[model samples]
Target: MVSDFRKKKLLHVFTSFFDRNGSGSIDKKDFELAIENISKLRGWSSGDAKYVETQSALLKIWEALQSRADSDKDGEISVDEWISMWDEFAKNPSAPLEWQNLYSKFIFNLEDASGDGVIDGEEFSSVYESFGLSKSDALVAFKKMSKGKGQVSWSEFQELWKEYFTTEDVAAPGNFIFGKTSF
Candidate 1:
């Protein structure tokens, strides 16, 4: 989360994470769970997460939120507290990780709305507005991710990201998105 674009990217990922959750919030325990998963994902495999989100995940996300969250000097968090934290993060997705955690706390125990073990084309499509991805772009992303049907796993996410996410924030691609994103 360095440049404006990276912040945008982080927000994109964050929004999706929040949307997938039934309550739209997360606590320390929830944050730890996400890190646990990321930690387990030691290596990449056919699109699997580079890291499953264990210590790495917790530390990263918490660092990301440190700036605005952690309101109480206590250090632990609750679901409501987390929601408020993410809201601020959403407003400034690229702010300093001075108070945030890059990989750990932000993405643990993600509540997949689709119940598919991962976010899917339909899920992403539904959430595109929050991510700032156009329906068309989201559709394109969905198509590439689905490759057919079902939810898009983290491994598949890598491939899809490479496709939809530009190599650089250099130039906007022509017709960035095409077709329709459907369930």
Candidate 2:
């Protein structure tokens, strides 16, 4: 089960990414702005291959978020909807198994920068860095998850992703998925 503190941390991470305008909600515009922001961070020009790839992945994530959190069918996700989704996950995370799986798969694909269906240390580190984790903290988490392996496979990644969202263990490597949270 997810602890209250962990739940709050996850919510904070989600809000940080999705609430681009700091408007307490995620709408299409905010989602698009997030894509542009990441594109700039990665130094992707409009016609670059990597830019296209990034846009594709962002679109997938955007659609998934809207499908899951747009409860009013109004094309926007209110803060209530966001919290409700988290509460539902906290209560019975498996209830939204399909969405979770799809979201995780999208993340895995995005992180597989080599297109090899695996996350190498650098790729894993990038994921952690995106959440503002320090390099040392990310390395520690990667080492823990990899267990001496040079890379983490899709199965392992999926397991870690689920644990990060569902488990309350403070020391779980997955707990570091979003850097450290003050609980």
Candidate 3:
């Protein structure tokens, strides 16, 4: 059984995805809206090759999350469904490695404003801030993740992703991937 703390952390992670509307539930409409917002924010366009790749990646993640968690098949995730999904997720943290890899790649691409295939410290800070993490903590995380390089490449980000999901160390830089969580 998942402990309360782990469950809360899992809930925070899951809710972060589909609770875009902040209605306290993940419904089809909310998911769709999130996709729309993300697509727009990421500059996804039909004519762009990156769009197809990113869209495919996104669809894979969406399908995985929905198929695993939408127990009622009504295209909505209730709190109970979230819990049930968390049970499954907690059982195998590495199960979603591909999903996480794709997600991290997409995020890296999104944050690499210079199109140089790397995220500078400032860009990384903005990403953290965008996720509601405090600036100081973002700086701390940036320092930890960048290792004094002041930039993170896609491969480095993948390593960080692995560490984020697998590491139990609260002091690990990966633990702060989502921000400094009191939980």
Best by TM-score: 2
Q: Can you tell me which runs of candidate 2 are displaced by over 4 Å?
A: 1-3, 90-99, 147-149, 179-183
Candidate 2 vs candidate 3, lDDT winner: 2
Across residues 36-154, which tens digit of lDDT does each residue of candidate 3 receive? 66556557766677666655666776676677677789877787877776566446756763444556676777667678988887776765565556777777767776766878887
lDDT by residue (tens digit), candidate 1, 116-140: 5586555555445343447666767
Candidate 2 lDDT tens digits, 27-118:
77876786677667567887888778767767777788788878999888886677677667757655664556666786677567678988
Give the candidate order by descending TM-score: 2, 3, 1
- Those runs of model 3 whose alpha carbons end farther than 4 Å from true positions after fitting are 35-60, 83-98
Global lDDT scores for all candidate models: 0.43, 0.69, 0.65
Show where candidate 1 strays beyond 4 Å: 1-28, 39-54, 63-67, 90-141, 144-183
**What RMSD, rounded to one decimal, does every model reach?**
11.1, 3.1, 3.6
2 versus 3: better TM-score goes to: 2
Clashing pairs in 2: none
In candidate 3, which residue pairs clash?
none
